[model samples]
Target: MGLSSRSAVAIHALTMLARWSDKSLTSAEIADSLASNPVLVRRILGSLRDADLVRSTEGRGGGWLLARAAREITLHDAYTAVEAGPVLSRHPHPPSDACEVGRNMQALLEAEFQDAERAMEERLSQTTIADLVQQVLTIERKIGRSAR
Candidate 1:
């Protein structure tokens, strides 16, 4: 299955919130970082809000923030919030049962695909938004030092 960009956007947004935890961020700012539009950010943020990973404020001087601590939120949290279904997709149509390989392919693919999906989930769960924020900070620090 194709990896959805939604998960990337959600993680990026969450890391932004954590990095700038002192203040709320408007969707437009996040969108600008993404080179995307506010509408897409809002929609993805909506899904994250529904998952309780994020919260939003409205009106003047209002925007979005994390609902929980960044460390409490895992990459799996972001992935699940915005994307659904298996990370590995099966065949578009069931293989013909008449042929030997076709008959066995679906089952074999299902087992292997599920394993891959589980492995990805395991890896994602191992990481948190806080981890990404720190990585970003470290990279920026290195860049600054090099510039100086």
Candidate 2:
């Protein structure tokens, strides 16, 4: 199943915050970098805040920051924070009970999907926000821009 754009955006925002650990980043600034709307950025940040992935501040010199160390945050955690439902949704149609394949396919599909999701989670758990941030920084350096 494909992940929603919100998940991607939230992960990017978190990675950006991790890279800029010394300073907070406003939604406007993040939007500029992501080429997205500031309001959307705020909405994504709001969700992250609720998940305790990020913390926000008001007033001047205020914005958002990672709630904890980047190394402690996994991609699966970010996905779980933004995803609305199961990673892979199945069709609701009841297979023809008369057929053995149809009668058993649902269970098979469910098992397969669960296994796939577990594998994905395992892979994601191995990589943290800190890893993503470092990759981004490396790309920025290769392009001759400071990874702010």
Candidate 3:
């Protein structure tokens, strides 16, 4: 919705690993949960691996595992691990200096965009992968009760 789905994929992969922290998970398994393909999952996971958020093994029984505890990894950690560039976005080309509005817009937009991005980053830092796992289980419990 914001930019590329890299952050989302990375976060999803993280939570899945945390949920099954007792064992490692294959890219195929994580991809299945995402309704995505294994190659894309591996690509995003590779970013996480480079970021030191996850680790993997090779050969038989090889898979992915969290490098750190879920509680120790914030949404911001996952976000920055995979996604790059500014959050809000900027124009590809600079505005014209001759036009009054165009001349003023870029500077104003820059400040606004930076502020928005900082706010988003701060909010993301407040939550962790562990928090999401608990929330998912809590919601599932409630839904199960209602279905009875």
Candidate 4:
């Protein structure tokens, strides 16, 4: 029915990872930055790990790291890795068949939804975590905040 914040969080976490590629970061650390729960961050990280977008380690000085360069990962890639649901979904049951509008509404909406989704995917494909990181840092600098 609606979009989820998982994709946003994934992108944010990835941007941080990209910015600090020299060191690994624990779920708690990421959670702190996102103002979210460590468990939730861990869960999200698990999904990213499964998607091969991130790697994790345990024990002393262990944490998560990007599987590859930020430039190699796109917003669309992050969106898919989280298994976010479709941008649009139909009603559970068809509307009344007796109604002319109801009978063709789904078909009409489906086509439009597909086109919208394709357009969104195309735009996402053009952006990367590194790009987002750069934007964030630029804004921070403009606001007189250190980008660390």
TM-score per candidate, in order? 0.95, 0.90, 0.94, 0.95
**Off by more than 4 A, model 4:** none
**TM-score of candidate 4 relative to the true fold:** 0.95
Q: lDDT tens string, model 1, 61-119?
A: 89999999999999999999999777777789988899999999999988998888889
Give Cα-based local distance difference scores for all models.
0.92, 0.89, 0.91, 0.90
Backbone clashes in model 3, listed as residue pairs: none
Off by over 4 Å in 1: 145-148
Candidate 2 local lDDT, residue 105: 90
Q: Model 4 residue 111 lDDT?
A: 91
Question: What lDDT score goes with residue 124 in model 3?
Answer: 98
Off by over 4 Å in 2: none
Per model, how many backbone clashes are there?
0, 0, 0, 0
lDDT of candidate 4 over 19-131, digit per residue (tens)? 88999999888998999999989888889999999999889999999999999999999988886667777677989889999999989988998899999999999999989
Model 3: residues with Cα > 4 Å off, grouped in runs: 145-148
lDDT per residue, candidate 3, 1-148, as tens digits? 2498899999899999998999899999999999999999999999999999999998899999999999999999999998888877687798899999999999999999889999999999999999998887788798884211
lDDT of 2 by residue, 1-148 (tens): 4557988898889988998989999999999889999999999999899999999988989999999999999988887888786678786688899999999999999999989989988998899999998888788889999844
